[model samples]
Target chain A: MLEEVVSGGGSLIIIDDINCCGRSLLKCFLAAAAHKGDSIHILNFDIPKDELRAGMDSEVAERLVFHDGFMDPLNWNGEAVLPASPFTLKELRVCIGADASPVTLVLDSLSWILLHNPVSAVCHTFQHFQRQAKSTGLNVRQIIGLLHGDLHKPAVVDSVCCLASTVVTVTQAPSSEAQGTAVVLQRRKSRKIVRATEYFTILEHFALKSLGQHQPLMKLAGEKEETPAAETDPAANLTFNLRLSEEERRAKERVLLPYHLSAEVKSSLLQSHAGVAKIYYEPDAADDVDEEDPDDDLDV
Target chain B: MFAAGGSMASSSFRRKVGGGLAVIPGTRASVHNGQLLVSTGASSLDSVIGGGLAVGTLLLIEEDKYNMYSNLLLKYFIAEGVVSGHDLFVASAEEDPSSILQELPAPLLDDFHKNNLDKEEKTTGDLQKSMKIAWRYQNLPKLEVTPAARSRFGHHYDLSKAMSSEMLQAVRCHTFFLPTECGSAICCSMGHAYTLLLQSIHRVIQQEGFDGSCPQKKHKNILRIVLQSLGSVLWGDDICCSDHPQYIHSLTRFLHALRGLLRMSLSACVISLPAHLIQNKAILSRVRNLSDTVVGLESFIGSARETNALYKDYHGLFHVYQCPRLNSLLCDVSGTKDLAFKLQRKQFTIEIVIHVELQGVLRNCLHLPPDLSDRASRSSKQDLSECSKVLNAGCAAMTAGRTHLDF
Candidate 1:
């Protein structure tokens, strides 16, 4: 789902679970980002550099420059930098690559950075990153930032989401402990958020495979049969709890009076009004025949 | 029986009876030529917004939960433009509008071809007669002797298949992909998005050799301006949050200016806004008031009770909360404004239904038992007499006061 957008050159922010699946997802993403021939830079804050390096094969590791963010005062893997508190955007830029030849920088964990720095600072850093990534000269291809949702405030997560062009949240399955979790991808297209959900399992060699083919859980034949039955009986699933008597229903129908019965009285009244007014000394023929007529000359 | 006339005759009779009460003239819907009624792709949507969308009007669609459905409607608007050969101006502050256009689904040609085959079976002489009548129908109002057959513009699209590039090529789409970066800060500011939008449209109008000064050209080709999503994070201002104090002012100003721009040109605008993201009902209501028409799409698929009650097979509830009354010339065409939409593979259907109110109305109208009815009747009579007595007492008091004043 993300291949088209990520490859096309944009920034993406992935908010994942605290479980190991998130780390596995990052590894898989790095491998994919590297295969695209982008100059890869990994800022590893949660896991040790050695652990991440040992986990991946030399082919993948050789393609990535891992920045150690866990260490106090943050070592840049032997790179020189005038250290600023909580890592300034200028210093981060030097680490990403001074001469950007289609660079893809992966911030493996953002919650660690947020723990030390304010959300506004992190937001500004990302703002600067997007500016660089989108520029024509820098040719900074993609910036993939990973964050753990369990460790950060939702406000922080949302602030980061606002800065990136695409946001992916890897939600763990409630019941399935062994099976992979749901990978919900939301991309900002034409100022609209287009969402697509898929399930992913991390495989050996730091590769990710989608769990199932994109097909409905139920067969098409069953759906066609079920729809007609439901359509014919809209109340098939509804249960009526309010009880009403037959006389009550009749009275109700009478009060809510059908238009046909009411229209007759209106039509006659309108036609009579439209004609000349007349003083009727006797009853009209339209009057009920069963009723007795009263005398007209009563003085009382 | 005096009820000799069926619905047709009864309707005419009623019209005569109510003629004195008729404050507004009867405006019968005509064909594509004279009136500026552009179809919004979906026939139900057309019905919802009166006969069809009026030129020089703005339609604001408030999106439901995820916004994908509203986006589909936007696509339908563009597809309608493409099929009708209207020039499209799509402005976005995020992704490329052209790429989004590429993602529009193709129309279902199977039904179209079948209808064409049926049309071909009609004799050429009959076709010529109909054609001659169609030309006359546009110029004149419906004569009492004959019924006027309404001609509809635009096609019903099938979103199951990929949109063919051939059809896309025929549409003239102008896209303004506003960058979110600060280097183009002046241009891409969400606060200035509406200004930039107006400028782009102004440029288009000027470039097309259309007179922007006259501001009253009623008969010209239609221009479609689509703003994909407003008030989203991607279209953020210098400050990122969408709820900045200036955001509302900027948006309302944009809509007002856009409406003014539309008035002079032969153009209609469709905008999709994420109400969920804005999360402010006051601002949302203001936005609704700013546009000519407002439609809301609410999905109840996630709720079990709501699903089981009536909307099990339906996609969502399509609400026509407001329809523009332009000089009272256009009558509300949709017999039932509120509808339930069901999107199938081939075509989507919007049906009218009243599910939740049946029980409520039934309770109100139910009759009492015999004993209860007797009691109710006696009480009502007593209540009426008591109310009249009170009124007489009040009248007497007023008369006494008048007499004292006279003295």
Candidate 2:
């Protein structure tokens, strides 16, 4: 669906958390857009400027616009400076209207706004932004909202969902041990696409890399073979005790191959050469092989 | 008589009265020969240790962000030995040997392959002929080597003879690359690949009877066990040691076992410990006691005075904090703080600053709903009550608190 939107010159609004999934989606979108020379305008609300800068290329840094301010939105204290916007809806309107079109507006996070601002006000502000973006044909407008179990209240989530065209829940998968975050999209009101999960990690500098790029997106084959009891319900309270045996299996496989070979080598050496003598590889052949394989012809 | 939950019968109390040193199980002798060689690849690290890693000693290399450096050093050591005709056995715990082999510098890999081909050329005519026949049998299409054909040719292609033929071929080559298949039912069930590798090396050394009786035999039996990201193994309760009560005991025992079995006059065992473990005094003491010659890599030392102080305090525990370049990589507070107040007195242009900022837009949107606070704290009863009262007082008090927002 995201691919279709981008290809069709439409924008997408992704909502997720900060740790893995949301960061990965944003990274993929940024990488794809940058590679295609499509303009990207990121308006991160949660991540600090330095952190974001550290993660992105200097060229991409040039494309990013950061809005930092003083005063807590919830308390309205003008003294304490916040990392993100402290603007009112009216002020936000002015900022959005002045910005260029065919833009990809990434809120970077909505959870911050919800936590700091009144839910009703945030919803209204989002609706207002949506109307403005629709009027401008901005192509894509993404408002990434991080939702931890402790912070995302149902009522607040519902209000935010109502304002979004599509809702994606980016989360850490149940069994993945790669420090990779996964995303699960739920259209909520729209037609459902296949429930897909993609794994990603936040690389140094807040830049995200998708682990699913080279590997399969999900362990569907393993999941299918396992009994239904193994299929965990995401909404259920997660227990850390749930060990992924497959991960252990993979680790074990990595350790054994060398031992088996060493044994074979040792036994052979003992039998072939006098059992008591040390086996040594004749040295002259290496020099001959070097003479034969030129720099250009080397397989490596 | 220690009774359950009895204060007087506590294990700690018993140790204090006896004044007996804690028996750390897996703690291995740090120096096998007199020298200790800690390999960090960087010159600064080598210098700090007063030289290269001790020959026939076990050196633990900590894991850093760029694991490539450690991997490179492992390959360098192995390649140096292989090319020099020194039989070397490398048992990698964390990564696949195939993958590691693939990542080895191409020229080095070519050298190894060329060396193998060289040895294959030196076999006697009959043995070479038999090897060719074995190779053909091993690589023949599965259908061609059917049970009926095997039975018919059983006299000519004896299974044991064929197997031994391949083994002989591998042994003739000094540089044998064994990619560990750790998870196979037989090995993994017994222990993790690292432990198994250690055990195998121990067995070989024992079989060879290299009890330091012959220095040449001892040097030739040197095996480099690379347990990458040992932090992963140490964190999980994968280490097993019988006599010692503590985790450190098991770790030290494992190391000692390797030291004795490998006949390592000088062997380097690289183990990466989690940042958290560095804080534990017991753990530090254990690691300190385990190695007679210690060299810390990537340590943060604030000033010469502080560093001197640490040396003065833990003089017997460590030899040197070496690798001042390590200070540059110390990003965490423990690294910084330990160096600043505990180790060094010189303030090398220390510029510490804190930046606090708020996030998201502020709006007085349709004042908080009457039930807003109540709804928010519905998850807990006590919170629900507090929220109800707050909600009833509608916008009674609004204070700024750190709240992480996710959208």
Candidate 3:
């Protein structure tokens, strides 16, 4: 199952790169929560809000609170672009005013936040939400952030992973656009860690259906092994010859050697001779045959 | 006859687009994801890169050893921009941008179809008239070319002829040439040509109304940006000079900012990086990661494959390292990985290698190790290079379910 493991307290990080899509998984989480009737506060940076609303149910779309960080992000147009800038989160509390329906905080893309600010500042932003959640009348049930894995340094990604309760890395499945693999790592209260890599398909409406452990990556090698063995001609695609030609076979038949016994020669020799055969035995020096014993010297 | 074909193409172009939004003259929406696409001046190349190049995206071309074919591709791109009436931005360090724009290959009259369209129509009519038994075949509706393909989104170019001066001056042009006249040193990152290039492009996008947030002009059009030999020694970049160049990060950082500019503007970029000369494979992969679509050209001029009988018909190998996955779960990849390019006198065609039916390709060509010196970079590029080797071994077992459409 592509389980929705929303931690009871902390956030979940969805890591993706240019090769795969993490937004689909993020939307799946949002859709699941909205069905349960919880408020979703999304900091929209990557894509427009209409795109997010496209595949979602009408009732679910109503629960989304969009903070416009995409249009006039740098305040370039000089018109009023509400909900504050991406680099600052001081207005986040004012934007989430009077809503206490157990909010699920979603950063549409944390990379955009990181590009303008330092790593330490971003870590502090996560900490500020966790420590100050209850006092501000905002019941932050879950915090989910989507990070582009390749854009940042490995150390930066690892440092962010340390702070999150769950981290999900996504990669595109081989030879498929609709299929992908999700490697999920979750840390529990008892310091126990759980990890799993599951293949999944984005069905119609992007309902993520898990394909379980059946991976196309492993299936490719297995198919390659079976085809060569089933071919009737064993030497079809080999680098060297496995069978000899007719001339080579005939040449092998003509060659003769000392003490090389053929089946035909053995049968002819046995039929030609009909004399009585005598039994003889040879003794080794190590056998300790006594010269005085007459029975020992006789051959029968 | 060509005029008749051109009229048919333009009329069809007008029919489908009546949404009240001004349709750009030479662009169309991608069927897969609805992203706007502009052609790269080569029909065969447009097919290979999963339809034409999308707007507000970067297309990276890894230059061959001699930088021959990559230069031609840049010309094709710029020529397409001029033909389509889009604004042009050409930046190069090796040659003057004006000269690069001046020598673009001539487009074949107005029609893109091979030979004469009228002659082909006459032959088809003759065949239908001669075959009296199959009278019903003439009444069947045609399905050879789709209505979308007939829109002339792309065109054929005669490579042997240069575009006329009248065509070159038909559109707006922006040029950037590195200033080395005063014996100003072209050091690694000090001259700051990349910074200057980025600044000028940013200025043009904002001033010329290419940027989405700030559209200054009533007529909205695309700006085709071409950066030739970007990371080579010519571009005052040092990523190619040593294993650890002083400004190794400069190129990648520039690409990141350039892409950011692209995302908000009606602009598309084509950069030809001399990847083979770059000492660090890590740097090359980073450059590839930053770009949206990456395709490499491997010329066979000095390679052993040039003398081989099996590859005699082709000039070089074409490797598509990456395709952009924009606003979708997966990128649209060309299924067949083994592709070759032939530079005919009149045209250039990047086709699925025709020798796929010849079974065992020249054993020597298959066994030769690729020219890549990659180490410590498991970026999966070497895996792409190894795909053809595995194919020529008579077991295309890896690419099992891929569609190989014979054109």
- Candidate No. with top DockQ: 1
- Model 1 residue B394 lDDT score: 23
Per-residue lDDT, model 2, residue A215, is 34
Worst 10 residues of 2 chain B by lDDT: B346-355
DockQ of all predictions against the true structure, Cα-based: 0.05, 0.01, 0.01
Candidate 3 to truth, TM: 0.48
RMSD to the hidden true structure, all candidates: 18.2, 33.4, 33.5
Per-residue lDDT for A141-201 in model 1, tens only? 7777788877765544665675577776776654553345544445455334454555666
> How far does residue B11 in candidate 3 sit from its true spot (Å)?
32
Task: List the candidate 1 regions with Cα displacement exceeding 4 Å.
Answer: A1-13, A16-21, A28-39, A43-54, A67-105, A110-144, A150-300, B1-35, B105-152, B161-171, B180-190, B206-219, B238-248, B300-309, B328-338, B354-407
Model 1: lDDT equals 0.62
Candidate with the larger TM-score of 1 and 2:
1
As for lDDT, the candidate ahead, 2 or 3, is: 3
Please state the CAPRI-style docking class of candidate 2: incorrect
Q: lDDT by residue for model 1 over B1-407, one digit each (tens)? A: 23675555534332223222122111223343334667777877777677677777888898776555787788888887876667889877545688779877676454565666557746454654444223333323333332221123656687776588998897788887665323333233446556666788888876764445544244245688898777554455322233444555667777777787887776788988866556446777888898888988876533332324345677777888778767566645555544777777656666775544332322233332223556665665454444345445222222322222221
* Model 1 TM-score relative to the real fold: 0.58
RMSD of 3: 33.5
